[model samples]
Target: MKKIILPLMVVLFTACKEKNEKREVSFPEEKTVETPKDTLTKALEEEPALLSLDDVADTTFVRLRDYNRDFVYDMKYATDDNFLKTKVYDCAECYVRAKTAKALIAANEELMGQGYRIKFFDCYRPHDVQKKMWKIVPNPQYVADPAKGSIHNKGGAVDITLVDTDGNELEMGTGFDFFGKEAHHDYTGHPDEVLKNRKLLKETMEKHGFWSIRTEWWHYNLTSASNGKVANFRWDCE
Candidate 1:
């Protein structure tokens, strides 16, 4: 009877141990991490929102880049690559009257849809810069008389060309600021591709309220900005 009882006790102990080892256990789930709302607010406050063109007055001068980032810039006067052969501007900035900016942005959007973009060589020349250009090339045909003030001085004009997605400027018969009959809108000496490229630029700009000059294939003036006062404020380079 003692031996049987001892065997039974050992069997019971082994069974209890097996059951304890096989018992199911659970642990608390980890919480998901999220950024704090105050941290997000601080981040937003660091970067100011871009202003809309509609919120600005039409005649007010504004940097084109501030309103739209789509247009490409190769401001010639800012460097010595222009007809002046001198860096007339402290920095390369494209500023136009708000009305001009609105039209240019619209025109660029149309060009972009056709897989091309507008590349600016000049925009909104200050009165002093115009005088400097006149001193270099006093030809009224090329450089407008500073006393008379050209559309550019009025923040109404832009010198531009079309560039493909690869940034290769389309063959517009002549380079920007080229003063020759070949650059004329009526000049038919160019190849068909060049004519087509010019037509695309001219028509698109006209459709968006800009008119092209008879001589400079690259120059366009916003119709509404024709009466704006000539501006002379220099942009801060820093």
Candidate 2:
């Protein structure tokens, strides 16, 4: 009986020891993950749409200043500073066909890359203003015939010169609306720098789809814009 009781007690003590030594397995604690933010999408959501030629019609007239701010404006005919010595325009505003404006913006960008920008003397003359200019000059060589209509009346031409980044006009050997052989592209009597400047302006303009006439150094016509209609619609000054 003693041997049996001792064996039973030993078994019970062994089972109790095994139960006390046993431990449940534990895993690592979980951590919260954070997602990265998309900055480009956030910025695009906050920004407005940019102006583009795609938003405008090719033949539609657009205010040049509204589209580009790099150009400098003199608008000679808008004041008494031109050869006509008359302010024909109601105000000094530059407007051009959408196609012409696109070409000019491209040309001006190229010029700006070369440390120069286009300074406008005249742009998109009204048909009535063209008639007024013809009455003042009365010469086809000096002014375009209003009956036939100039490219300016058609919103395809710009009278421009090179200006530095500081807005100082480059010496092109002739002022805007200067009616003489000196303004002629073939005339080689000017200084080397003047010739170089004129060549830069001409070549750059021609490269951007403009053609210069033999009579005017400041004038350029957009080849693509030649087919546009003559416009007499005036811009309000207020």
Candidate 3:
């Protein structure tokens, strides 16, 4: 009886040892890899949160770049290349009313889906700048009177054109600020390609609550900005 009991105890001990070995082989401990502190901090700095325009008042003036970086800016008035032939703005910056900026962004998004984007020639002219423009091209057909104030002075107008993904400007019969009959939207004397490009820009802008004048293919005014008070405050060049 004593020998039999001793053999059973040995068998039990061996079985327990085998079970422990299998458990150790089946599940190994996991190793954790730590990221360097500096690398993690750099990544966070590169992707700061963008400000939202939703809480801003519709009439509030806001820089377009702050809300979205998708649009291109030429800001012709900020340079002598414009029809004015002199720099009117202190700097080349695009500032529009919050409402107008929101609509422009929406329009740009739609155009981007089709491989095109909006390029601004001018945006949100201050009342004084409007006067300066009128002095150069006083014709109401080209420049709005500063005394009465234009939609641009109200921060709701934008002169813009479309550019393909390659940054090539779309042909629209005539270049921006061209004071001629050819610049008219009704002018069908242009090639089919020019007309199609103009149609694409006009239709998209109209869909986003903007309207164009008969003489300038690049000019568009936000419908809601018609009643906005003309603003004389200029943006800081900094």
Model 2, 10-64: lDDT tens digits are 9999999998789567899999897755875565555555467778988899888
lDDT of 3 by residue, 1-238 (tens): 9999999999999999999888845567789988767864575567546679989999899998888877877989889997778998999999999999999999999999999999999998889888888888888777778889999889999999999987899988899999899999999999999999999999999999999999899999999999999998788877
Cα lDDT tens digits, model 1, 115-214, are 9999999999999988988998898877789988999999999999999998889998888878889999999999999999999999999999999889
Task: State, as a TM-score between 0 and 1, how close model 2 is to the true structure.
Answer: 0.78
Q: Residue 35, candidate 3: how far off, in angstroms? A: 22
User: In lDDT terms, which candidate is top?
Assistant: 3
* TM-score per candidate: 0.79, 0.78, 0.79
Each prediction's whole-model lDDT (CA): 0.89, 0.89, 0.90
Please report how far candidate 2 places residue 93 from its true position, in Å: 0.3
Ranking by lDDT: 3, 1, 2
Off by over 4 Å in 3: 1-49
